[model samples]
Target: MPPLLTGSLYDAYGSYALVPAPLPVVAATALVLTATGVRRAVSHRAPAVAPH
Candidate 1:
């Protein structure tokens, strides 16, 4: 059961709808991966200047 759905809400779903239950997990994983990749690329774009 996904955290967003309560017991009552989850219970309302029929067997057919259960097939797509993993969609949310897949979407969340993709979002996390994209954010991490973007953050890494941006952070490494410039180097710190060395002191004389």
Candidate 2:
């Protein structure tokens, strides 16, 4: 089983919703991926300069 499966299952039961069971995992993954992508893009945009 996948790691997120357990959390998603718990969420499903806790909320008593059957249709949106995977919502939490999907949202979390999207948020994490977006943040990572932004960080990488910003880091690559400019180079650091050394002090004289």
Candidate 3:
């Protein structure tokens, strides 16, 4: 029983057809990974202000 199908709460998915069960988690994980990779690259690109 998925949450979107007539659960305790009313969701906008009522009008949509064939919603993916794993889509939300998959999308969130991808977003997190992308953000982390970008942050790491930007940090390495910063110039060193102090002598080694």
Over 6-50, each residue of candidate 2 has an lDDT whose tens digit, in order, gives 567668676434536667878899999999999999989877788
Model 2, residue 20: distance off in Å is 0.4
Clashes in model 3: which pairs?
Answer: none
**Alpha carbon lDDT of each predicted model:** 0.74, 0.74, 0.68
Candidate with top TM-score is 2
Where does model 2 exceed 4 Å of error?
A: 1-17, 47-52
Candidate RMSDs in order:
5.0, 7.2, 7.0
User: Which pairs clash in model 2?
Assistant: none
Worst 10 residues of 1 by lDDT: 1-10
lDDT of 2 at 14: 68
- How many steric overlaps are in each model, in order? 0, 0, 0
Q: How does candidate 2 score on lDDT?
A: 0.74
Candidate 3 wrong stretches, greater than 4 Å: 1-19, 46-52
Quote model 1's TM-score. 0.52
Q: For candidate 1, lDDT tens digit of each residue in 1-52?
A: 5555545455677434564667789899999999999999999989879999
- Score candidate 2 by TM-score against the native: 0.54
Query: Which 10 successive residues of model 2 have the least lDDT summed?
Result: 12-21
Position 8, candidate 1: lDDT: 44
**TM per candidate:** 0.52, 0.54, 0.49
Task: Rate residue 50 of model 1 by lDDT.
Answer: 93
